[model samples]
Target chain A: MLEKANDWSDTFYDKWKPIAMGFVNGAEKCLQCGKCTGQCPAAAVNPSYNPRKIIYDLVNGNIKRVLSSVELWQCFFCSGCFATCPVDINFPFFVFMLRLGAMSQGFGWEDVKQLEKYAEKDYLQDGITVSPEERNPYVIEERGDIADIRQKAGMPRQREVSDEAIAEINMISDLSGMTNFMKKIGGVELYDCSKCTPKIEEKCKSKELPKKVGNVKTHYRFYNYGVPIGGADNA
Target chain B: MHKLDKLSGIREEIVADIPIPEEIFYFQSCVASNKYPGIESCTLDVLNKLGVKPFVSEDQTCCGGFVTFANVAAPTASMPAVARNISLAEEEGLDICAVCNGCWTFLNEFGHFMNGNDEVKESVNMMLNMMGREYKGESNIFHIGAMLYKLKDRIAENVERPLEGLKFATHYGCHYLGGGKYGAIDDAQHPSFIQELVEIMGGENVDYTASGECCGTGFTQVINDKEKSLDHSQMKLESVRDEADPDFVIVLCPYCLSQLDRMQQQLDYRRDVKLDIPIIHITQLAGLALGLPKERLAFDAHIGGQDRFKKALNKIGIDY
Candidate 1:
C-alpha cells in the first residue's frame, strides 16, 4: 500500500537547496540535541521516531528518505519536546516540515492523508484543517463543546472570514512553499482536511498538486532530530 | 512560581470540597438564577470545601455585564450600575466571588474603571454616596477558577482520593482567557493550571490539543441563527476530540459546562465525528474523587453520568 524507495539521482539539485535553507533558518531555534527524542511521548512508544535521528538526517542531506517517511507524523508537538531542549531546538517544527515534504514529493500519502481528515470538513467553510497551521503553534482557541456552550451563553457570532479574506489567506498560504508542498505530497485538496482516509484514496491523490507555494519552494525535514530521508524516497 | 504560590491554599472540607470563604459575598450572575442553577449549587459545593462563608444580599440584578460585554449598553450606563453592585458587596465587608466571568470581570474592572476614568469613577462613587454606600474602590473580586488554582497546594495536600490516569483537558472559555485585560491564573496558550489541580488530586491530565479554545456558547450571538450556532458549539467540541482522547473534559464556567454536557449530545449526531468525551465542572470532578457520593456530588444529573468519572474516582482512591 505504501511506496518503497524512489530513484534519487542527486534529485535535490541546486533549485531546492536555497528554499531548504529557509527551513533551516525558520528552524533557527533548533539545537542539535536529542532531548526531543528522549521526551516525546510518541517517540517513547514508537522507536521508529527518534527526533535526534531526523535532525541528523537533515544534515546528511537525506531529503529523499525524509520525504517519504511516516516518522514525522508521530510527534505530539506538545512543545515539551522543544521546551526542554538545551539548545532550544524545536524538532516538532521540523515534524511540520516533513508533513509538507511528504506531500510535496508525493510521499507518505497514508499519514498525510490521515492528518488531512481534521481539516477536511471545516476546510470549505472554516478554512484549513487542524484549526491552525501545518506546524505546531500549539495554540487551541476553541474546542467543539466549548464552542457549543458559547452559543448558548450568547458568545458573539463571528462571520466566517469573507470569501475575499479566505482567498487572500489562501493566497498567502500558497506563498509559503511548504504549505503548497503539503497539499501536493498528501494529495490534499486545495481547501479541505476531510476525505483523508485510505478509503478516500481518490481524493487523496492529486496529480497537479501545487508543490511550490507561491514563489517559494516547499521542502521536508524528514529526519526530525534524526533524518527525514529514511522513508521511501531515500530507501 | 510566586504567581503559582499565590494559589495553593489548604482544603478544609470533605463532601462539597467547596472553598470556604471566611468572608464571601455572593456576587450573582444574570443567567445563573433563571438559567443554569447547577452553577450556583456547584459554586456552593466548592465554597463549602474551602471553608468559605458567603453572604447573599438583597436587590442584586444583572451585574450590568450582559449588555455591556455584548456591546448593546455603553460603558456610560454599565459602569455606574456595576459600581452600585460592588458597593453592596463592600457594605457586607466581603470579597466578591461571581460564578460567572462576566460578574468577575465587571466587578474587577469596575474598580479599574473607577480609578482609571475619574468622571465615571466619581459618578459611580457619587451614586454610592446617595445610597449611603461608598463603592470601596479596592474590593477583591475573583472567578471560581482563580480561587481553585489558588488552593492547588491545599488540593494536593488533602486528597481522600487522587484521580490518577484519568485523562482530563480544561476549556478556559473567553472571559477567563480574554485579551489578557481581565487576567487569568493560567497561561492562555497552554493552560495546565487546572490540569495540575487534577493531577495533584491524582487524576490524569489528558494531553489533548484543543484544551484552550472557545466553547462558542455565546448566549446572545446565536439566539436566532441556526448554522452559526451549531458551528460555534461544534467547532469547540471537535477540537477537544482531536487528540489525547480522555475519560472526561473539565470546565470552569457553567455556560461552557452546559454546551459541552447538555447541548453536545443533542448535536452529536449532526457532527461529522462522534466524541465520547464527557464534560463536567472542574469542581464537580474534584468532588467526585474526594469520595463524595453521587447524590451530594450530583454526577448522575449529567447526561453520560458518573460512569465517565467513576473510574477516575476509583483510581484516586487507589493512588491515595
Candidate 2:
C-alpha cells in the first residue's frame, strides 16, 4: 500500500526541499508559465503530465501528492523544459528529485527496480550496463546479431572492463550509499553545494540563487545553471 | 523564452571556434555497445576516416550517467565513477570524446561539478584514495557529433559516396543540444550542425517542427511509464511524418537511437500505425557517405529497415 501523507508540516518540506534543490533550482521562481508544459513532449502526449502543475504543486508543499502521482513518472526528462524556462529551471532534475523522494518512501519501486539489473551489470562488468548477447538473447534478437555484426564490420568484440576498476567501482558504490539507495534504504547524497570551490561557489551563487533557509541552502549547479544543497546531515 | 528552434542553420563562427584536437580518449557507451554495437564501430570508422584516432582504455567504465540521472543511484556513486573515468582519460593526456550524448553530458556536467566543488572533489578523492586513483579534472569532454560538425568541410572533401537528393530529418539528441556546456557549440534550440552535415554529404536537410523534439526515451520513463515513453516517440515521429517524409532521421545519442529505432516498431504494433522512418546515427550516415560498406555501418541492426537507404545508396552508385 502507498504510504499516505497526512502530515503536511514544515518537516515535509525540510525532508524534500534539500533533495529537490540538490538537482533543480528555481522552483520558487516558476512564473506559472505553461511554457514548460507547452514545450514538453510528455505533456503533448499525456495531458496529465503537466510540468507547470508539477512545479505549482511542488512549491505548495504537495510533495507526497506529486511524488505518488503517475504524472510524475511520465516525464521524459528530455529537458525541453530546461531549454524553454525563462528562469532556467531544470525540470527534468526537478522530476528527478520527486523520483528520489518517491524512492525513499518505497513508492514506484516495482516500476524502477528493474534498472537495478543494469546498475549491477555496470558494476560487475566494470562499466558496461547492458549485458552482451550471450547473456541476453533478447538483446541479440532485438539488435539482430550484434556480436556477429561487429565481427563483420571488422571491429573487435566490445573491450573487457578491468577487474580492478570493477572492484573499485563496487567499493565506491558500497561507500557512496548506492547499494543502500538501490535497496530503498536511501542514504545516498547526490550533490552538496557547500563543498564547492570558490570559483564554483561564485558560479553557483548567481543572482537566481534562492535565499538560504533553515539549514536548506540552494545551489544552482547544473550545466552552467542550478545549484546543489546537502539535504541530510550526512549528505 | 529560449526559443527551441529545430530548423536553425549552422553557426559557422561557432564551428570555426572549435579547437580540433589531434587525439582524444574515446568514451564508449554501454547501451550503444550492447544494443547497437554498429554505432560505436561506425563512429570510429568515421573518426578514422576524418583523421582523428581516438584512444580507448580498458580501465574506462560506463559514465553511469543514465543510472544517476535516472535517480537509480545517487550522484555520490556515479559522480566518482565518472571522475574515475575522466581520470583515466587524463592519464592518457588526451581530451575526452564520446559518441553518445548521455556520456558526453554526464562527463561534462560531472567535470564541472568536480572542478567547481572542492569538498565534493575531496570526498570523491577520499574514495579514490582507497582505489589508488585520483581525479585532477584535466580533460575537456566532447561529443564526436560536434567534431563531425566542426570538420564538415574536411569531411565533405573526403566523401566518396555523396547521398544526393535525399531529405534527412536530424534528431540532435536533447543532451547534445540542450545540456549546459554543449549548448555553446551551436544555437541550443536552433542547432544546424547535423543539417549542415547532411547538406555537405549531398543530402537535403528536412526542416520540420519537432525536429528538435526528443525521441522520448526518457531514462526512467522508459522503465516506469512505457506507454508515456512510446507516446513521446510517437509524437516526434508523427510530427515528422506530418511535416515531411525524410529518408532518415539522424541521431547522435545512443538512447535516442535506441528509443527512436525500437519504439517505432512498438508504436506501429500497439497502434497499428506505420511510420516507418529509419533512424541512423550521424556517424553511420557519415560512414555511408564516406563509402564504408553497409555491413560496417550496421544498417541491418535498426528496426526501421535500411531498404530505402540501401536503394538510395545503390542509386548513387555506391555498392558494398
Candidate 3:
C-alpha cells in the first residue's frame, strides 16, 4: 500500500527542480487518468511496474520509497505512456530522471555495472558501443561475415571513425564526467537486495535465472512488487 | 480550459513541420553499421535514388545514447558527445538524416535538452570548445523514415518494380513514434505513415492490433530482464501473426528490425508457435521497389525468415 502523505515535503522536489521547472511541469499536470499505465508496455508484462502509481507518488512527494524501489528500473523507455498521455507528461523522460536520482542515492548500480561490461568498455575504446571485437564468438563471426557481405555490396567493410574523432570522443567522455562517475560507481557496493520481495530472493537463491539474458550475460536480479494493486493486470 | 482543449493545444505545439532537404549529413548508426549494414547502405541507395544527397563524415563519433539508455550514464554525461556529433553536421551546413531511430531520437532529445537548458548548453559547449567545435543547434535531425515519407511521391514515380501482391505490416518502433514532443511526422497514437509507404510501393498494408507496441529491444531490459522483453516481442509478433499475417513486417529502425527479426527463432523455440515473418526496413522495402539488387539490400544479415521472404518473392513472381 502507498504511504499516506500526512505532511507534504518539497525536499525531493527541490532536489530534482529541473523536472518540475522544465517539460510537462514534472507530472504536476497529471490528472490521475491512468492513461500512462494503460499504454505502458513494461506495465503490461510486469504487474508490479506501475507508471501511474509512480507519478502519483512523485506528485504526492513519496520520493524516497519510489527512488529505491525496483519498479524505478522496470521502464524500457518505450515512451508509449508519453504518446497516450492526455496532458503529454513524457513519462519516459520522467522515469529517466527518476533513475538518475536513484543512481545518485546508490541504487541500481548493479545495472550500470552490467552496462559498463557490455557497452561502456567498447564505447570508451572505439567510438562505437557494441563493437564486434568485444562481443561473443558468434557475433564476431557474424559481424565479420557481414563485413564481407557489405564489401561485396559496394559499401565499406565497416564504418571507419577517424583517429581524430576517436580522440575527441575519449576527451568528451572524460570532460563530461562520465569517466569519473563510472570509476566512482565501479567501487561502490551493489544495492542491497535483501530488502526486496521474497520472489526476487527466491530467484537469486535457487539460481534458476539464466546466466545470459537476451544478448548480454548478467547476474542482475529482476524485482517484483509484493502484490497486485487494485487487482490491475494488463497481461 | 477543458481537458480536450488543453490536449489539442499541446498537440499543436508538438506537430512539427516536415522539411525535405536536398542534402543530409546522413548520421550513421552503430547497430546498423555493425549488425545490419544493409539498413545503412539501403537508406543511402534509396535516398540517392529519391534525389537526396547523403554525406557521411568520418569525423563524427557515436551519439553515446546507449550509455544513457542502458542506465550507465546520465543524459548530461552524453551531452558533450551529442553536441560534438551535431556540431559535425552543423559544420557541414546540412541537416542530419539518421537511418536508425536511436541516432535521430538521441540527437533530437539531447539537442532539445541543451537548447532549453542554458547551463547545460554552456557546459556542453565548453567541452566541445576544447575539441575546437561548438554546437550551434542550427541543423534539424530527421529520421530517414520521415524523409522517405516526405518523398513518397518521388518514390512512387521512380518505382521500377512496384511491390504488387506483397502484403506488409508496419512497425514504426518506439523511439521514432513515441519519442515525444518532437513533432513526429505522423500521429503517435495511430501512426500509418509506414503503411501508407507500403501502399505507395504497390504493396498491401496489413493492420495489426499491436502496431503501436514496442519491439522489446529495451536497451538494458533485454539484457537484465530478458523474460519480460521477449514476452513483449512475443505478444507483438503473435498479434501480427494471428491478426495480420503479412508477407513482411516493415520497420523504420534497425534496432526494431534486429529485435523482431532475430527473436522469431527464439520465440519458435520458447513457444510452440512458428512466426517466420521476414522483417524488412522501410528503406530496404523502398530499395526493392526502386529496383536495387537484392544483394545491395543485404537480406543475408537477417537471422530468420529468409526462406519465407524468398517464397514470398517467388509467389509475387518478382526476380531481382
Candidate 4:
C-alpha cells in the first residue's frame, strides 16, 4: 500500500471543493450518520470503502487517502448510499466529481480507458459496444455460437448499429469532447508497482508497457460456461 | 423561469402516470445487441403484441452509459451525445423507450441536467442544430420495465403459456432502482414492478436478501478490479441461491443479465457452489408468456443453466 501523507496541499480539494460545494453544498449538512456506508454495496464487499468516511475525509480535508485509494474506484455507483443518506448527500455524484479531480491530476483509475477502444469501435462497427471483433478468439467464437443459436431459433443473424448513427456518434463525441477525453485517458503510461522489483523505479523505466489498455488481471471476455471454441486448445 | 421549476417540471414528467405511448423511439442498447441478442428481438416482439410501434432508427448510437460510467467519458461529452440522441428521437416525434436500464437512467439523469441547466442545454442544442436536430425536453423517457408495468393488465390478459410452477427472482438492475431518486418506475427502496410482472406471467416472485443490490457490473470494477467485481456479484447470487433458490433470475437490463448469466460460471468455479439458476430478461419471459415460440426467444444465447431453465419450463408444462 502506498502511504500517502495526510497533507491537504497534496490533495486536489482546491479544484474539487468548488464542484462539491456547487452540487452537495460541501457535505455541510452531513449528520455524521453512517447510513451511506451501511447501505453501500461496495462497502459490503470491500470493508475499506466507506461512503460516510469519504464525506468525512473530504469535509475534514483528509483528501489524500480518498483520491489515491483503490477504494475510490470500487464504488459500484448503485446510489444505495445516495438513496439512504439522511442529509440527501449525493454520494455517487461526489465520487464522480472526486474521480474527475483525481483524473485531472492523472492519478485516478486508468482501467476505465480500456473501454475506449470498444467505444471507438462502436463508431466503426455501427453500435455494438462489445463486438466480437474486439473480443478474444474464444469470445468471438462464443459470440458466433450464440448468434448461431439465435439464428437457429429463427431470429435475425445480423444486428448492426446504424452507420449514420455511428457518424452522428463520432460528430457528437468530437464536438462534445468525449473523443478527446477518451484519447487522453486511454493511453497506457502507468506501471503497476506491485509487479516492480527491488530497484522499483529503475525496473519501471526499463519495463515495456503493454500495447493495449485493459484489465491486467482478467481476460477480455466475461467467463463463458461452455467449451472453449477458439484460441489455443488448452486455453 | 426558476431552475427549480424547470427541475420540477422534468420531475413531474418522470413521475407522471401517463398512458403507454402508441409509438416509441426504441433506443438500441449496445450491450443487448451483443451480449444477449434475445433481449432486443424479444423486446420488439413483446412491444408488437402490446400494440406499440417501435421506431428503431439506424441513425441512433449507443447511449454511451458504460463509457461514461467508466469515467472514460465526461458528462460534458456524453450529455451532448444524449441530447443529440433525444434530438433524433424528437425529430421522429416519439418518446424514447430505453430498453436498457443504464440507458434509461443515464438518459433520465442527463435529461434532467440538460433541462435544468439552460446554458448546458443551449450548448448541447447548438451542437444538435448543426445536425439539423433539436431537443425540446418534452418527450418522456421510460425504462422497458416501467413500460411493462404500465401494460401489466394487458400482459396478464394475453398470457398463453401461463408460467405457473416456475419460480423467478427479479434483478431490477440497480441503475433503475438505485441510480437516483428522480422518476424511478416504482418504489426504489422496495421496487415491486417486476415482481408484479412475474406474478402476472403466473410465476412466483421470490425476494432475496440482495434483491436490490447491484449485480457488480460496476463499470470500473468490470474493467480493472475484476476479482472484486465478481466477488460482489457472487455475494448477491449466493444470497439469491440460499434464500430464493429461484429457477431463473429475471433481469430488466442486458448488462445486469450478462453479469448474472456470465458471472454465474465464474462464481461456481471460484466458490465451488452449485448454482444452476439461469437468468432471463423480462422481455424474454414476457415473450414466453405471450405465446412466442421457443425458437423466437433465442434461449440458447443465455450462458448459464440452460438445461435447468428448460427443465423448469417443462415442469410448468410449457411445451414451447
Q: Could you tell me which residue pairs clash in candidate 2?
A: A127-B62, A196-B117, A219-A227, A219-A228, A220-A226, A220-A227, A221-A226, A221-A227
> CA lDDT of A151 in candidate 1?
38
Per-residue lDDT of B290 in model 2? 91
State the lDDT of candidate 2 residue by residue for A112-158, as single tens digits: 55566667655545468766644434435655566777777777765
Decoy 2 TM-score against native: 0.83
Clash-forming residue pairs, model 4: none
Calculate DockQ per candidate and list them.
0.01, 0.30, 0.46, 0.35
The candidate maximizing DockQ is 3
Each prediction's whole-model lDDT (CA): 0.50, 0.71, 0.74, 0.70
- Ranked by TM-score, the better of candidates 3 and 4 is 3
Best by TM-score: 3
lDDT of 3 by residue, A84-118 (tens): 88887888777777776665555566666667754
What is candidate 3's CA lDDT for residue B141? 84
Mark the 10 consecutive residues where model 1 chain A has the least summed lDDT: A130-139
Model 1: residue A15 alpha-carbon error in angstroms: 55
lDDT tens readout by residue for model 4, B214-259: 8887766666667668778877888888999888888888888888
Best-to-worst DockQ order: 3, 4, 2, 1
Q: What's the CA error at residue A230 for candidate 1, in Å?
A: 38
Please give the lDDT score at residue A7 for candidate 1: 32
